[model samples]
Target: MATRWGLCGAGKISHDFSVAMKTLPPGDHQIVAVAARSLERAREFAKKHSIPKAYGSYEELASDPEIDMVYLGVLHTEHWRLGLLVLQAGKNMLCEKPFAMNSREVGDLIAASKKSNVFLMEAIWSRCFPLHREVRRLLAEDAIGDIKLVKASFGSPQLHIPRSVEKELGGGALLDIGVYTLQFVLMVFNGERPESIHATGVLLNSGVDESMVVVMKFARNRLAFCFFSIAVSLPNDATISGTKGTIRVLGPMHCPTTLEVNGKTTQYPLPEPSLPLNFTNSTGLRYEAEEVRQCLLKGLKESPRMPLSESALLTEVMDECRKQVGVVFNQDSQ
Candidate 1:
């Protein structure tokens, strides 16, 4: 049976997601509807994607019986509220990254998912890439022995983007792009919580972080360093060094299609999408969509690869990082 999807936002990310869904077999995935803040916008997105239904309100989408899952791709600040609505409405959800503004929101959504007995996943699309999977396999095989240090950075000059700079909108380099680097570090360390965290950053005039450098010390003297920025351009690559060898994830770390193991480069190309994507390599989203379908078919409430626990941990790490760097969101006090 095809897992029907109802998209909860009509933005560029949602558009990319819808386009990526088209890359999969129609028999396995179907976008049944889309909802946006404005009815006209929803209708336009629906028309663009050829979806069967369009809703002006997210509540309408959540209550939809035809939708097996809801993809919440709204702004960072809205995830908690919208996520709870979907889970409470008895719908599975694949929420976009920085799952919520803080760990408190993540906890509430998680509890709601358990209470509703529905599948819920944080849409950290990078973890689903073929390149990431291969990296995991190599790590498991001890290709990079001991795993001494992991370094990653993701930076883009997004000073002109309102959503990337506004504090009220939950804008900041840490929450926006740092999540990818943090998740990458955690993934390399097998989701183990770090023993200590140190973060320093440059905050915009709005009091949100413009650039951040974080160092985490994990078990057995293992260390991970991450640099994220919206004010500057960075190498945007990741390197993992071990006692024996090294593995490097090439630039555009969020959705990379290439990796270098001990200086030997290999590429994992993405599937072609019918529509042009707003983001790079978004067709790789098919992997996560397929994972959701398979998990739903098997009656699972969460994905093993991107578990709810990991989401919580990732959010907690971000929370600590923000606290250390003095980036405060409105939701933090609530």
Candidate 2:
């Protein structure tokens, strides 16, 4: 049986997700509907992706009895509200990164999912990539030997985008791109919470972080450093160093396809999509979609690869980071 998906937004990320979904085998996954604030926008997205239904409002989409899962791709600010609606409607959900505005919202969403007894996962697609899985395998085998240091950066000149800088929209480099670097570090340390976190950043007039540097210390004298920015372009690369050797993840760390283990380089090219995408290596999203399908097939309530606990931890860390850097969102006070 196919896992029917109802897209909750028609933005660029959602468009990329739709394109990636097409790359998967049609018999296993299906996008049955798409919803947007505007009916015309939803219709246009549906027409472009050949989805069977278009909804003018999220309520209508969530109410559809045919949708097996709802992919929440709306702005960061809307995640909590829309995610709650989906869970309350007795539907599974795959919410985009920075799952919610803050840790409190994430906790509420998790509680709602548990009460509803439905599958729920944060859409951090990188964790499901082949390269990432290989990295995990090597790490478990101690290929690098006791990870001691981790460094990663993800930055692009995105200040021109309204949603990237607006405070009300939950905009900032930390929540937008920094989460990738932080997640990379957490993956290396096996999801251990840092012993201490320190952050410094430049904020725009809008009170959102424009650029930031974060440093964390973990057990066993492990250290991780991350740099993220919206005003500046960065290498976007990540490196994990250990006592024995080093592992390097090539640029665009969030959706990477290349890796270097002890100076040996390998490239895992992305699947060729029939349509152009809005983000880099977005076709790789098929892996997460497939993971979701398999979990649903097995009657699982959460994905082990990107579990709910990890999502909660990520939000908690980001909350502390924001507090240190003085990046406050409207949702933070609620």
Candidate 3:
């Protein structure tokens, strides 16, 4: 295996992932090609990363026989199609967050991936991070004792901004920031999907949810509550409390701002030139890409961290939460 990575969507996220891949152990990984909407953008991205090939379109990238895997950073609406294309073309794929528009879309991708004898996964980088992984370990070991309640949130003051709240683009706090919160809750619950949910939220003119508060109840009285807002903020982080102790995960908490066990808190010293959870940030993308590479080497089609089933259930949770909150987007009402 050449250990080469092909990138679809030479945008901020693909660029970030490329850079992060470079930081890996020498000879383990390399970005060989990139494809984008415009030829010039692809060329520029290739130049920036020293990639060997640049294509003017996604189909061109998907056509590369030498490419072993493709990382997709396209829009959420297009993930399903692009994923199927790559799978059919005989390449593994790691798509950006919100894996697909809904569970049905995810089912399509999953079936295609299996049919094509390849792999597929969601890039929920936060769940694969060292500390985030540690949190799960502690919970399973009962370091925190039997889990009780979970609280999490992620949002910014961007609800008023048109670009950040576009319904057509699948915008809104719930799908945008809230997905992360929901993923956090799901992880702490030991893979059990929520049995019942109660929610409330703010809707935008585009008919999308701008802010939301959700309470998810699982088996044995364990409850997880999440808050998301384009109107306000709440540490935009997470706290997992159990019988023995509590763990607090800080902002953009996927990669974690700070991870504390019990009363002692030790920050992991920020990466050089702080990386935000944006298309331009490589820190989180790097870990996710590495996980994909590792899983592939191990002959796994779905990652143990953020598998396809979880992505499917997570999508349903987000969709139903919106429904319960009486928030209907253009897509939903259609």
Candidate 4:
């Protein structure tokens, strides 16, 4: 069945999602409609992407019964509203990361989804990559024994837009790049919410976090140190160190372009990806799309692979961390 898709924003990341749908397995997915704040922008995106419909308002696209799913690539603060719109429209929703500004909004969205009987998920994307899946399998197989410490970080210096620091839009490293870093911790530790957390960061001029470091502790004495920043980009990576061996993710850890294992000071490559993986252009979007397809086909509302509980927990972690770090978004304090 070809899943007709409605894209709910014409942003850069949304454009990437559109591109990824183009590469999906034939008859699996297609972009049927595109919507933006304005009809002109929506028409332009529709024309560029060869979409059949363009709407000025998100409601129009969401209410379109032909759209099987809606992918939201809007502002961070807008995710919750747009997700609710799509869900209430009787369509599955794949929202951009951060899911919502806080756990409260996420909880609200989750409840609405359940009430509406619609599928809803955050668009983390990184959790579905083949290399990362192999990494998860390796840890399960005891390739790395008794995980001890893990570190992950991602950032880009180019996103200097004023909105990046604007607390109103929920713009910050934790919501942006930090989502991927936390994925590393969640993946290795089986999505266990941290028992304890302490985080600190420097806020930008508009009071959003520019850089942040969070420390988390989980089951069986496992620990993770996650870092993120927009002030300056540094390495943008993740490392898993276990008792027996270590695994170093070779790409921003978001869409690892490579992975390496360490053996007594010797380093070697893990198996290269089998199918063509999207890193730069798509950033693992295709894999997530596949995950969603499988989940929908199986009649599942929440993904066991990326459950809503973890999604809420991650935001809670960030909320607590942001509080401790004194990184306050304008809307958060309201």
Candidate 5:
């Protein structure tokens, strides 16, 4: 049976998700509907994606009987409200990253998922990548010896992007890209909670972080350092140093397939499906989509790879990071 999907936005992220869905083998998945604020926009998206239904408002999409699940591709600022509405309508959801403005909203969303008994998962995507899975496997095998330090940096000149700098939209390097750095470190440490966190960042005129450096101290005398910036470009590489050797991610640490473990390089290619879409980033989204599909078919409410509790903990870390850097948003009050 095909798992029918209703895309909740007509934005770039939704477009990418639609392309990934299109590449899936028949009967595995189907994109049945799309909803946007503008009916014209939804119609255009449906036409481009070959979707059967289009709705001007989200309510219509949420209430559609045919859609078993929805991919909430809207901005982080709108996730909490729209997510509750979808759950109330008895629809499962795969929400985009930076799940909410703060941990409180994520807690509420988890509560709603429990009350509704519908599957819910955050779309971090990277956690499901083949390369990341391999990284964990190698670490568990003690290939890198005792892990001592992890360092990563991600940056781009994205000031022109409205969402990257807008205060109301949950802009800034940390929430926007720093989350990846933090997640990567946590994954390397097998999701160990840090004993202490300290962060410093430069804030834009809009009161959002433009660049930042974060240091986390963990038990077992381990440490992680992350560098994030939107003002300039960085190498975007990540390194994990251990007592015996080091593992270097040769490409974009967030989504790259190439890894150099103790000077032996290996590349893990994306799964068989080919993407014919504008956003190549969509290429990797398939991994998490498949994870979601398997979970749904098994009647699971949360994914083992990217669990709801981890999402809540990550959001809480971001909230504390924002507090240390003095980045506040209007949505934080809610």
Candidate 6:
């Protein structure tokens, strides 16, 4: 049975997701409709994807009875608002990541999901990757021993993008790319919240964080260090060091297909992609989508691999980090 999708937003991210969907075997998934603020944009996206329906407003998409699930590809700030709308419409959702602007918003969404009796999951697709799953298995087997220090960096020269530095858009290194490093660290620690978070960031003139470095203290003498930026270039690698040895995910580790453990390397090659696009490892998106499909088939509300609780915890950690670093989005005041 194909899981029909109502795609919200017709932006680059949505396009990437649609492209990824094309790589899946037929009958696994179907995008039934697409909605954008502008009718023309919605029609264009629907045409490009060969979807049957186009809606000018999100409300129309919400009311779509044919859609079994919605893929919310809107901006970071809109996740909470649109998430509530989707849940209220009795729709399951796979919302794009940095789930909400803060922990409170994430909590509200969780409540809505529970009340609506609909499944909800954050689209932190990296957690569903084969390499990440393998890493978890190795860690569980004590391959790295007691993890002492985890370090990661994700940075890019993306200042030209308005959303990358605009405060109203929930722009910042923390919510944008820092979430990757944060989740990566949490994955190593088995989703344990840090005991203390200390961070410093370089804010743009627009009052959004352009770059940040965070050091988090954890129990059992464990620590995590993360660096992210929207205005600079970084190696974008990740390392987890422990008493026995170290595991290093190679550059572009955020959506890595390869990682090194104890100086030995392994690669998890993605399926041959049908599309040649360079967006966020769309090749791996199918893994998460399949996860959602399997869970829905089993009547599950959240994925065990990337549970809603972990999503909220990650948001809470980011909230504390932003408070300490002084990266304030407009919604934070609301």
Q: Which sections of candidate 1 miss by over 4 Å?
A: none
Q: What's the lDDT for residue 172 in model 3? A: 77
Clash totals for all models, in order?
Answer: 0, 0, 1, 0, 0, 0
Query: How many Å off is the CA of 111 in candidate 3?
Result: 1.4
Error of 4 at 143 (Å): 1.2
TM-score-best of 3 and 5 = 5
lDDT of 6 by residue, 1-334 (tens): 9999999999988887888888787699999999999999999999988999999999999989999999999999899998899999999999999899998889999999999999999999988888888889889999989999999999999999888888889888889899999999988888887888898888899888889999999999998999999988998989999899999888778788888999999988876666565575777888788889989999999998889989988998899888887877778778
Residue pairs clashing, model 1: none
Please report, as a residue range, the 10-residue window in candidate 6 with the lowest summed lDDT: 271-280
lDDT of 1 at 280: 82
Runs of candidate 6 with Cα error greater than 4 angstroms are: 276-278
The C-alpha local distance difference test score for the whole of candidate 2 amounts to 0.93
| CA deviation > 4 Å runs, candidate 4 | 263-283
Residue 86 local lDDT, model 5: 92
Pairs of residues at least 3 apart in sequence or in different chains that clash in candidate 3:
12-279
lDDT of each: 0.94, 0.93, 0.80, 0.80, 0.87, 0.89
Strongest candidate by lDDT: 1
By lDDT, the better pick of 3 and 6 is 6
Q: Mind sharing the TM-score for model 2?
A: 0.99
Q: Which digits, one per residue and each the tens of the lDDT, describe model 3 over residues 1-334?
A: 5467889998777767776776676477878889998999999989977899999988988989888889998877678778888888888998888887666777888888889888888888888777777788788789987788999987678866664677667777887778889999988885797889888887877777878889999998888999988877567679888899998887767567468899778675434423333442346566787788889899999899988888888988988897887765544443
For candidate 1, what is the total of clashing residue pairs?
0
